[model samples]
Target: MHLYFLMIFFAALPAWFLSTLEGWITVDCTRAAVSSPMECTVGERFAFSSRNTRYATWKARSASLHRHDRRGSSVSYQLVLSTASGEVPVLRSSTGSDKIERIARDLNAAIGAGSTRFSAEAPPDSLFWFASFLVFLFAGVGALIALVGKRSGKS
Candidate 1:
């Protein structure tokens, strides 16, 4: 039974990763020339506003793109804005590194700042690695339990 459950869990991982690609955020700089800051709006592609829609504004001079390395050659990118409080992520993506990099370059050009790429190494305890460890741990324990149970039944 546990083996069957493990199979199901493994099959669901791809579906979960794909589901994350559904939403997008748009950064608008048209108003920047009028002394207005750039704005990032989420859920614009869906043409409907829900509670999940997010609105953020920041001066272009203070924002840049950040790329974070993930497990298995995967990369996560985000548009980060530095403010008095701290850096805030206005947009994010786990795929499409080229497209995201292009957008970041264009935005940086508009801001009059050179486009910069910041790559952060993945932490040892990243979610993906941790989850993978847990899965293997459980599988090993389950296999041991089953093996013991079978041996005892044969006695």
Candidate 2:
């Protein structure tokens, strides 16, 4: 009896781990300040004009949030942009947690953001398919084990 359970558990172990593959969680960016959500990826060059500049360019990287003080609830976000010399903080905005999160999400979606301390890298469709295949394979193996166990008992 114990042997049967062990066989089943081992067969399903890979599937169990693969099943944890999660999809991208959608966020509400309705309140974001961007004129429109533009698709972006890391290291991509984007052009935007501020009042003082006519032709300004920036390389998209990622955004991060920070707190003003330990006792303060005020939150701010800074867009870490890459320039010819090095990375620099090009933009900063003070907002609440929810709005800050939305801004981060917008930057990520626009620039194909990478994994950060607070968020994860988006999983590809192939990963989900591979995980599904493993699940089916384990199910078949478990069924075969059940059949063999039954036959041996009958004999």
Candidate 3:
């Protein structure tokens, strides 16, 4: 029983870590801000930190939907901002492309000086997906262990 509990706790660890990344992005004509749990990661606390609060214009760009053929047919969509420096990813979704596109449209429209662009390049989302996979794997293993332990104890 104790081992089962320990495994369950370990499984929840990844989910807890991922939860830290959950936050909101607020964008307006004046500024764009990213707020996450404790603002621990880069670009999490503030999207436009001391560099420049105001942008001349905001352009919305989407990378081609990536179909991970090897990863159980998972498809991911990314939305990014095209800045003078480079493209900054704002949102990533694995559920649907339409929602992300609509969000990009809204964001660009909100900024007033907005444009839309689609690119063949995909945004870097390997880290996010890797973390997500870890969470899933850990949780699944934990559950399996718990189940097996329970059965063995009964036997």
Q: Note the Cα lDDT for every prediction shown.
A: 0.43, 0.41, 0.47
lDDT tens digits by residue: candidate 2, 1-155: 65567456755766665545432322211222343333222221111111111111123344545556668754333434444556654332221223334534554564343322122222223554666667667767777777778889998
* Model with the higher TM-score, candidate 2 or 3: 3
| Tens-digit lDDT track of model 3 for 1-155 | 66656566766777665554422333334333321111111122211121123333346654656566655665555556666666666542332333456556665554453223221212223444555678778867877877888788998
In order, what is each prediction's RMSD in angstroms?
10.5, 16.0, 10.2
Q: What order do you get sorting by TM-score, best first? A: 3, 1, 2
Model 1: ten consecutive residues of lowest lDDT: 116-125
Poorest lDDT segment (10 consecutive residues) of candidate 3: 35-44
Q: What residue pairs are clashing in model 2?
A: 40-110, 40-111, 41-111
lDDT of 1 by residue, 40-120 (tens): 433222112221333333432223234555544545555555434555655433433334455555565654542122211
Residue 74 in candidate 2 has what lDDT?
A: 48
